[model samples]
Target: MPHPATVVPEIASHLKRLLDFVDPLPGDVCLDVARGRGPLPALLAPHVRSLTAVDAARDGRAFRTGPVRMPGDALTAAPAAPHARADETGHPTVRADATALPYPDGSFSLVTARFALHAPDDPHDVLRELLRVRRPGGRLIMADLVRGNLAATSRDRIERLRDPDHPGIPTIARLTEMVTAAGGAIRRLDVFTVERPAEPWLADAPDPDAADRVREELLDEVDGGPPTGAKPRIIGGELWFTQTWAHVLC
Candidate 1:
């Protein structure tokens, strides 16, 4: 069996394909809000001129590539680590919130929210902030799980059990209304079904002495068992994963 972290690279390969479909322009200055674990930023680093990876949690920010520890910017009130001001490409990462960006109006050519828009206290305020940093004719790309678009009842119920900080992932029609109403024009929208087949992980009881027992326990506490009706009958059976990607131009 392979280590969980060891499987990340291959998973990132698949994630890149999804990201490319949403934002394909090479050499574009991009902002990745809530870039947990840096998979998107790592794959995107080489493809673009520069990548600004931002997150509120310090633990969720950094990514290591070999001996070099590439840490991301932290968005706390009293900043601890100095922000990655700029790299060779002149694109630097900063610690900031989506609802109140730290840049001047129309500062970036491209702004992206991958699985991040679903956590703001106010999604509309976050949308307005995304538009604030984008230049005229620039683009904003958002990827999130669309509400009621789940392929499985279990998945829908699972999301409901998630943190209250999680954003209300509205349907496609609602997303369209929110974006255009906030001065962003909806250019394109894609729905990607993300299916995670049932595995032994779902059936077997967790190991009490496992290295990540605490972590596993936390996950379970937050969302106990499979989603209410989202599970399939057979173990290792096919399941559906659905996420929405919307491209908006400001």
Candidate 2:
């Protein structure tokens, strides 16, 4: 498996793409829901007027470890504070649930959820909560894994095996329905594919047997067999698959 340090740049690149797509205003007060590990919060703090990053997980140690260093930026340590949870850049971190945000209505100019919607049990409810905290005419952006084909059930099953917290990957239509039901007027939607090696992907699997099963199934699928609906293939001696990423703005 690749070291955690090596993964930071890849994550930063992905966040940069999402940020570019959202294009928040300089004066916008942004909220990043499910902001695990403080990378998104750290990257976003320098761009917006203020940032509030929250996650259901209450591990403050992750935040105090310091933010991911951007390309060409020097690495720095996180601030030493107890009651004050702000990092070195002054972006405050909170521990909260996404289904019911604690903030008052119309509290933020921009709200974002990145690679997090799939874990929520009630995605529509979470979207509604995000909408509730956003000001009138404010923007809501979500980026998550999506399955385009109806036959991708096996892919979803494999994902749940890898991460039990992953409820399931949503279909593009379901995503649209949830956003609309939450009072968002679908402004822009973009879908793209990301290919990555399979071993690293399953490195964090909650169940080793399940991970083995997933690996066997994926390998079989890639050996000149049915598509498995996940676009799996072996490229340059590495097992790889394409994951669909959807960016929705409303």
Candidate 3:
């Protein structure tokens, strides 16, 4: 796991931005749908009545310790930690699939899912499930990776190479349509770009050799081999790419 000391500030910024969509009440109960773990408790606990953290993944999925998250298959060996555990965050935690949460309808005043939508076969299934659990007039927010203007086929190709579980990241329009189709309304939308190095991001790939292959492919894109939608570039002689993220508030 990555040391919490160096990464917390950046993670905190990402999460606080997610919280900006609503006027949070102290009495509101919140659910954080995480694929992995991070500093959620330290950041989100103080804002709500109660917070429950859950995920379908049992092992190294992307770590969404708070709101901003790595891709589901991004880091295996370098997840941000210390805040990853519920006990440490002092919140109830459950091991459950996002598409089939055990909670009843209208159970929570708030639901926040980060970096989890792309894993399910149909993201609409997870969205509907999230909407089903949220109370009427309550807040529902989700953050996900948004693919760039490049060829989605190349992007999906490399994402699957790292972890086969990833169903390609969505375009902004497609994502909003999924939300609306699932009976959620988009009250506000926030999009941002995060530029990160390719090395640390791929350090914990499920297959080490696969990581090398992905690196080659991304570099190939940099060398004009193909458009990957990853928008790879070299920064200080290191491979880097910008990931677009969207926070959809309903």
Candidate 4:
């Protein structure tokens, strides 16, 4: 079995902010794109009528009492409550790619992609797909890292070194443009920064040497101007860096 993830303060705060931005309605049928381990699904289930969480990989483990199942092309074929007897949460997990959702167009009342935008091979295509799945006038929300111009280029380089699957983080302006191009009008936008500890953040890096190099670069910026544009600082004897997050609604 996979170990339970510890919810760090930074992540918790961000999730809270995202929830606030989304303000899910009780009648809304929501879809969480790239929802790994189902944090967003758990939080959203109470507010939304039904929640479907999708990820690229098919994991055997259930998340927050929801059954993990292979995604069907037709959402209508799935039972209204797949785990109604076993679990009251009633949300379902589906294995599918974000760039091409399995559900038909206008299937959901609300669609959200949080913290997973940077991992997609084609974020633009994924955003378009997300829009396609939403019903007319339904809300589409996205929350992800926004790169500042000062460190945008270098940040992408360091992130790719840390995670080979990392596509790249775009600026807030870039994200807005993508959303607009995907047939979404801006409803709301909230921008904030989170300070994350360096060690824990780098612990998951696949390449140790690359992690070290990225660490050195971040550390170098601690005393001077931040190199990657994320403000690096020493707080309470821990090396911390900032990442800007944008909660956008369309």
Strongest candidate by lDDT: 3
Off by over 4 Å in 2: 1-12, 58-92, 149-151
lDDT string for model 4 (1-250, tens) is 1121233445656667778889999999988775354466667878878787775433432111111122222221123344222222333446677787888899999998766566534777878898999999898898777865444587777777777767777877788787888777788888777776666666667677877877777778875745766566776666777767778888
Q: Which scores higher on lDDT, 2 or 3?
A: 3
Per-candidate Cα lDDT values, in order, are 0.50, 0.67, 0.68, 0.67
Q: lDDT by residue for model 3 over 1-250, one digit each (tens)?
A: 1111113235546666766654467998887786766444345666777777775565655532113343332211222333344433443346677888888899999888877787744679989999999999888887778764443666667777876666777777778788899998899888898766676666656677887887888788888887666787886677876678888788
Find the number of clashing residue pairs for candidate 1. Answer: 7
Tell me the spans in candidate 1 whose CA falls farther than 4 Å from its real position: 1-10, 57-82, 85-93, 148-157, 197-250
- lDDT tens readout by residue for model 2, 2-100: 222223345566667877898877898888876354355556667788777766443332211112334444211223223336545444546677787
Report the lDDT tens digits of candidate 1 across residue range 40-70. Answer: 5655556666566765333433211011112
Once model 4 is optimally superposed onto the true structure by TM-score, how far is the C-alpha of residue 178 displaced, in angstroms? 1.2
* TM-score of each candidate structure, all chains considered together: 0.63, 0.80, 0.78, 0.79
Clashes by residue pair, model 4: 151-228
lDDT of 2: 0.67
As for candidate 2, its clashing pairs are none
Candidate 2, residue 72: the lDDT equals 40
